[model samples]
Target: MGTGNADADAVLRILVVEDEALIALELECLLDDLGHVTVGVAGNATEAIAMGRSTAPDVALVDIHLVDGPTGIEVARALSADRRTTVVFMTANAKRIPADFAGAIGVIAKPYSERVVASTLDYVADRRAGRDGPACPDGFWPAPV
Candidate 1:
């Protein structure tokens, strides 16, 4: 959880799924900067599944398209099936995602500012803390229960 909060319980184990090395690195850095744990990263659906099984991430920042295939959409759904974990799509191809994607809480479009990511994640933390108000950020929809 990087160096932000000293309280270990506040940290979130996050799974990152992006094929591009640089983007993956940046995403990891960003999550770390926000004091979240990078449980693991995977470039494909198979590895993503494996990581999810092993890490049991509290949150997942998934890309819609991976090097292996455009399987991230399904990956997000599968990961979100575990009620404890929430999945958010962070991709350049948000337009391609179906509006009614059943298993994701929200989508954070590519080239998003760090502030946007932080705010969204802060909202997740609040929800995880069992305090909830609105579903998601202004532009996103919450995942179905």
Candidate 2:
């Protein structure tokens, strides 16, 4: 666990809840490059929720539509119930997200760039540390708290 300080080299335990194998792999690799750990990768709501409970990751990057269907929202709702985990939607269907954000902190539009993802992770880490990070990244939409 991080002390919530950005300069502390916070190595977040992140879970990738994307169904696409390639995307998941890329995110895992990116997380490693960012000096963060990829706790787990889940391709469905069931697996996502299970991993969330078991791994207790600091953050979860979820896709709206999974292999099972549009069950990512369900996974978010469940995971966010545990304050230990912060949920962020990583979906192409941004418009499909409910206004409440399913208890998530924000949404990152798909086809994301490495820079954007890196910036977003930093912002999320700050927020989790109880610090208000800088303005949201270009393709990110922070949910109304």
Candidate 3:
């Protein structure tokens, strides 16, 4: 099984699918701090779908609500077609998620803390490392006050 460091290899290319510009930028910055590369940022499902096909990122962070017709769940399903890519949903709505997205790494609730985001990323990385069980890396903290 691959280790967390193995998952962090290859620049950890990622795609951010969000309609809100500020949130997108925030996520991009966070990914940057983690040493991950943001290959593409899309405002809606259609654009996200296109980017997914072209960029082929190692992971995709998608917001549930987008400008385009389909929700982020739709985009997640589309991007996840490539087994190499991990799909993570970002939204304030944590009550429920589509049944089709059962395979997603996890949901990152909005108004997200840096700790939440970091933990989510670490979890995804661990899963990619072939660890079936949940694993939360140390040193995560909520967004600064």
Candidate 4:
């Protein structure tokens, strides 16, 4: 885990940006199980940006594609202007991630299992806590061991 003194149970406010309802709910459940708080869910980039501005979540889990014209990276860039918001991309098309988003804290490929999600959450939490340098969680791109 990344270095930090913050409690693992810390309630991190989070925003979920995904076009699919089922996936959004699943992500919410995963966040809940991790003791994180889901502040908002957006099906498109527009709403995601709006929610990010309004809620100012600690982190945002964004999918590459949204219902609207702008992509998740676009929303991340806009919302991240505050610099306090951490961004993670959850997408099947890892290769499609914007070049600039390579600087994001982490990326989780789709078809992720419970373990993968958990590890990603740990990585994010650690990053927020200032424990480890921002990097995609180990094994995030590979199938769960």
Candidate 5:
């Protein structure tokens, strides 16, 4: 657990569940620049589950649809079951998200700005560390906890 400080110890282990290779790569670069590290990148539900289990990432940035179809919802449900993992969806089809968010804590709409992604991750880190993070950004939708 972190101390709610934005230091090296606050770096979050991230898992990216997205089907688009280019987008995945871009996100990886951004995460790295933000001083966080990506544990793995999964293009499909099966791969996402396997990697998530093995890596036990602090956060998972998941897409609504993957290479195997709209299985990101299933992936989120499974990963978020592990109390150590926090799931956030990054998708264009926010409408497809069920009322419960399938166990995800929040969502970021696609075509997202890097600033939004960065702020969301910071907020997640703070909350994970038991601190009330900054206010949810404009582009983010936080599920009622």
Candidate 6:
């Protein structure tokens, strides 16, 4: 729901930094369904940085493991250089993300569902709006009422 780069009410231009083709495709579809646009998909650190520069996405959904290697964290670090970009790590091994990595906004575990994705986005929106009360504990977003 929230990985793409979007303002509060605008369609987000998203940059998907996942190496898996199928997962990347599914993410694109889900973002589109949520009224976001997939600006590009990257499979490695190099590609991710390139896409970030060209697309200037509002947010990036990055996987910790990338095509080049375990460089997802590197990608996130690089993308965060842009003040307008928010980085969210998405990986099966969420434990890899550092507890105090300021470059990232948050993370969501892999094998997520449609509703989870939607809720995650909503949570990100809250974060951008400065209403994110606390760091989401384990990314558990309550079901929308």
Best by TM-score: 5
Report the lDDT tens digits of candidate 3 across residue range 21-124.
98889888877777678999999888898999998988898788789644777788888888878887777764556655645666777777776666667666
lDDT value for model 6: 0.77
lDDT of 6 by residue, 34-142 (tens): 8777889999999899899988888898899998888998899899999878787888867687655438876777877766666666566666666748355445422
Model 5 clash pairs are none
In Å, residue 89's CA in model 6 sits off its true spot by 0.5
RMSD of 6: 5.1
Ten-residue stretch with the least lDDT total in model 4: 1-10
lDDT of each: 0.80, 0.87, 0.73, 0.75, 0.90, 0.77
Question: Once all C-alphas are superposed, what RMSD does model 3 give against the true structure?
Answer: 6.3
Q: In candidate 2, how many Å is residue 122 off? A: 0.5
Taking the tens digit of each residue's C-alpha lDDT, what string does model 2 give over 1-145?
2212346546688999999999999889888888888999999999999999999999999999999999999999999999999899999988889889999999888888777788888888777677754677676888987
Question: Which wins on lDDT, candidate 2 or candidate 4?
Answer: 2
What is the number of residue pairs that collide in model 2?
0
lDDT of 3: 0.73
Report the C-alpha displacement of residue 72, candidate 1, in angstroms. Answer: 0.5
Q: Model 6: runs farther than 4 Å from truth?
A: 1-10, 129-145
Worst 10 residues of 2 by lDDT: 1-10
Model 1 gets an lDDT of: 0.80
| Cα error of candidate 5 at position 25, Å | 0.2
Question: How many times do residue backbones clash in model 4?
Answer: 1
How many clashes (backbone N, Cα, C below 3 Å) per candidate?
Answer: 0, 0, 0, 1, 0, 2
Candidate 6 TM-score over all chains jointly:
0.81
C-alpha-based local distance difference test score of model 5: 0.90
Query: After superposing candidate 3, which stretches have Cα over 4 Å from the reference?
Result: 1-11, 131-145
* TM-score for each model: 0.86, 0.91, 0.80, 0.82, 0.93, 0.81
Q: Which is better, 4 or 6, measured by lDDT? A: 6
